[model samples]
Target: MGFRHTLRDDKLYFYERRDIMEQRHNYLKKIRQYRREDRPIVYLDETWANSHMAPERLWLDEQGRGGWKRPSGKGQRLIILHAGSETGWTPNADLVFRSKKNSTDYHDEMNSEHFLEWFQKLLVNIQPGSVIVLDNAPYHNSVVEKVPTKSSRKKEMQEWLTRKRIPFSDKDLKKDLFAKIQLSVPNRKLYATNEAAKACGHIVLRSPVAHCELNPIELVWADVKRYLKVHNKTFKLADLEQLVPDAFQSVTPEMWAKHCQHVQEEEERFWEKDGLQEESVEEYIIELGTEDDDDDIEVRDIEFEGEGEDSDGEQDECEPVMDENDRELLRSDAVSDA
Candidate 1:
C-alpha cells in the first residue's frame, strides 16, 4: 500500500557482488586517505552532447499553440573529455571533437589511443602528485598486457604463459596452464593508464563499476547539459558548437567545489555504511556459530532498502544553482567567443 508507481530503470547485475563491494570499500578508503594527506584530487570522465539537445518542455499560449517545433531527430554529436579538481578545470585538458558515428553509447566514440592522448595532456596540467579519480570505463582500464581468461584458447593461454616466462609443462592441459598463470599473477592486473599516471607522479583511483555518482565530473556534465538544454535555440550543429564553450564556462570554481564536497559526503556515507555492513555480518556469524563449529551453517541474508538510490530515495540530480556572478561570467564568455 505504501508503494507508488514509478518508471523502472535497468541496474547493473553486479552492483551488489562481493568483489564490487570490496572494490567500492577500497576506493572510498583510498579517497579518504588521499584527502587526509592533502593530495589534490582530479575527477575525469567523458560525455556526449547531441546537436538538438533542448529542453523537453516549453511554455505555450493559453490555446497551447505557440510553442516552437522541435528538431526532427538528434543531429550530430560532440564527445567531450576533461579532468578537473575542486580548484577548477585543468588548463589545456579539455577535448571536444565531433563524433564520427551516431552511437548510442558515448564510450563507443572513445578508445584507448584517444584516451591516452587526452590523459597525457591532463597529466601535464593537473597538480603534481594528484589523485586522479576515474570511472571504470573500458578505455581507462587498458591493460599493459592482457591476462588470459578461461575464454582464451588453450594455445593462446600457453603462449601468454611462455611470454611471461612462467614455467609450464608442454603436456599441461588448458586448465592446468590457467591455474599456473593465476598462481603466478594473483594480484590485480596492471593498467597502462595507472602506470602512466604513476610515471607523472600522480595516482589513479578507479571508481567501482557502475558508480558514476562517485565522480564529481559527472555532476559537471549535468550542469553543462542543463545549460545547453536551457539555451539551445536553433538546435543547429554550428550553434551547438558555439554554445558548448559557454555551457562549460557556466561551471565556476565555487560550483566545482560544491560538487566535490557532495562527492565527499557520499564517500563518507559509503564508508560508514560499509562499516555497519561488516559489523552486521560479523554479528550474524557469531550468533550462528563459533569459528570452531564449522558445521556448514547457513548465514541469514540481509537486504538494504533503496540499495542503489541516494539518501533521499532518488538519483542525485545535482542541479546547479547559478548566481548572478556565474550568469555574468557565462555571458561574458559567450560575448568573447562571438
Candidate 2:
C-alpha cells in the first residue's frame, strides 16, 4: 500500500449530486452552442464592499511595525450590480447604492425588485438578442407563478391541477396530486427575469448551482476588490465611494476578454470530465420530492465561500490557471491604475 498520512483542512466540498451534475452539463452545452452561433454572451452578478475593506496582510519591518490602522468595523457597505461581455463593462449598466443592512452576506441587501430595475437598465443599454448569464440567487429566480407544493392545501393543489388541465383524479390524496403536478409540469415554473429578458428579445441562461467559476463576472469582482484592498488607506465611507468607480475602471477590456476565455476553457474541462464520468459510473437518476421535503439543497449567490476549492485538499481541476503572462498583465494593470 502506498498510502501516506495527510493533514485535512476545512475546505469546501462540491457535492456532485446527480441533479447538479446534469444541470452543469446542460448549461455548458447550451453556452457552447450559443458561442458557436456567435451570440453576445453577457455575465451579470452582484457584489458588495465595505468602507474598511483593506488588505488583510501588510509588510512588517524587523520591529513588526508596518501596517495601517484601519477602522474598527466593516463600515457602511455598498451593493454593486453590473453586467459585462468580452468587450468590457456595459455602458450605463452599473448600479451601486448604499446598503440598508451591514450584513456580511451581500444577498441580504438585494431583492427581486431592485435586481429587476437594474436588469431593465442593462437590457436598454445592450443590443437585442444577447444571451445573459445569471446565477441561482433567490432574487434572480423569483417565480412569476408559483406552482403548488406539498405544503399547499389540498384545495389549492386541486385548483392548480384543474387550471393546468393536468387530469388529476378528484379523489387523489395530497401526495398523489403533488406527484401528478411534478410529472405534468416538470419544468413549468417561469422566472420573472427570464420573462423580462424575453420581452426584450434577449435570452437568460442560469449558471448551474454552486458553479460561480462559470460566470466571468466573478473574476471581475475579484479584480475590483483587489484594487480596493490595495488602495484603500482612509477606510472611510466617502473615500470608498470615490475609489469604487476607479476600481471598476481598472478592469480593462483586455482583462474582461481574458476572464471570459478562462471561463470558456473551464466549461470545456467540465464537458470532458462529465463525458468520462458518464462512461464509468452507472447512470444516476435523482427522484424529485415535494417542496416541503427537507433535502440538503444549497441555494446561494455567486459570491459563495471557498469558491473553486475541493474538500479533499486537492486543487479543483476545473480552476483556471494563471501563467506568467497573465500575472504580468495583472501587475501592469495595477501599476497603471496607481
Candidate 3:
C-alpha cells in the first residue's frame, strides 16, 4: 500500500509544536505526578563560582565576629556540587581541592568520572525510590561496554559463540572464530546508561533543555549566591572554601519547600494560559536581542558518552554553549547581618 494521510472524514492531520512555556508546564506536571505518586525524587545540579570579588566587602557582627581584609583584585574560580530533596539541602562539596590528578590547580571542573564517583557515593544512600532529576548534561551520563557479539576475533568470537549456544561446536566454532562470519545484518548494539539506571531503580527524569526555572536547585543557587556575594570580603581562595559551604547551609528546608511550591505555581500559570504567555505567542512583537551581561548566575552543560551506539560509526560531541562568566556586580545590600 502507498503512504496515507487524513483518511477518515472525521479528522485531519496537523503538525503541532509545544512552545517553551508549555514544555516547562509539562516538566513540572510530570515531576508533580512523581511526587503525587510518592516516588522518591531528588533534584541534583551544579553551579560554578562567579566573578563577584570585592575590591572588598565584609560584614562585622556587633556580636564580635572577626573581620576579613579586602583584596586588591580577583582570583581563581570555583565550582560547587550538591543535591536537594524535599527534606532539605544535601551536604555540599566545593571543587577547590587541589586536583589529585594535576596537583597544580584546584578541581575547577566536573567530568563523567567525577560525576560517577559522586553517584556511587549517592546511589547507595538514596531513599528507596526510582527517580533522579538530572539535567541534559553530558557529565551526568556514561557508557557501559556491550557484550561481544558473534562477529568477534578468533578467540573472542569463539568465546561469544560458545556462550550464546550457537549451533557451532568446539571444532566448528573454532573455525568460525577467525573465518568470515556472516548473517542477514550487522548486530549493532551499544550500551547506554539508562540500562544501569534501570538496574539501580531510577527512571532518570531529565529537565527540559534551556529551562533553569524548572529546576528547584536553581532557586537554591540564587539564595546561596546572595550569601556568597555579601560575605566575599577577603576574596581569597581559602576564604571561599569556608564561604561556599556556609552559603549552602544558609538555605533552609523551608526555602526548598517554597521552591517546589513555586514551580507548582508556574505550572498552574501555564496550564491556565494554555501555555501561551503573552510574549511567547507567535505574532507577538519583540525587542532586539540583548543578554543581561551582569547576571551572576550561569548554568552550563557538558557532554558525556552514552552506552553503545548502532553498528554505524558515530560519536557523541560536546555542545559549544560555554557559560564563560565574567565579573558580577555586588549586591546592593552586601554588608547585612553577619
Best candidate according to lDDT: 2
In model 1, where is the ten-residue run with the lowest total lDDT? 280-289
Per-candidate clashes come to 0, 0, 6
Candidate 2, 96-124: lDDT as tens digits: 88888745466778877878878888888
* Candidate 3: regions farther than 4 A off: 1-29, 50-74, 91-108, 146-193, 274-338
lDDT of 1 by residue, 226-328 (tens): 8987888887877888888898899999999999999888887777877833221110001111112212223222111111333222223222223465457
TM-score per model over all chains: 0.73, 0.73, 0.55
Q: Please, what is the whole-model Cα lDDT of each candidate in the order they appear?
A: 0.69, 0.72, 0.51
Candidate 1 off by > 4 Å: 1-18, 65-67, 166-172, 276-338
lDDT of 3 at 95: 35
Candidate 1 backbone collisions, by pair: none
Q: What is the lDDT of residue 156 in candidate 3?
A: 65
Task: Give the Å error, residue 256, model 1.
Answer: 0.7
* Candidate 3 per-residue lDDT over residues 115-136, each given as its tens digit: 7677655665567665777665
Candidate 3 residue-wise lDDT at 81: 71
Clashes of 2: 0
Q: List the residue pairs that clash in candidate 2.
A: none
Worst 10 residues of 3 by lDDT: 283-292
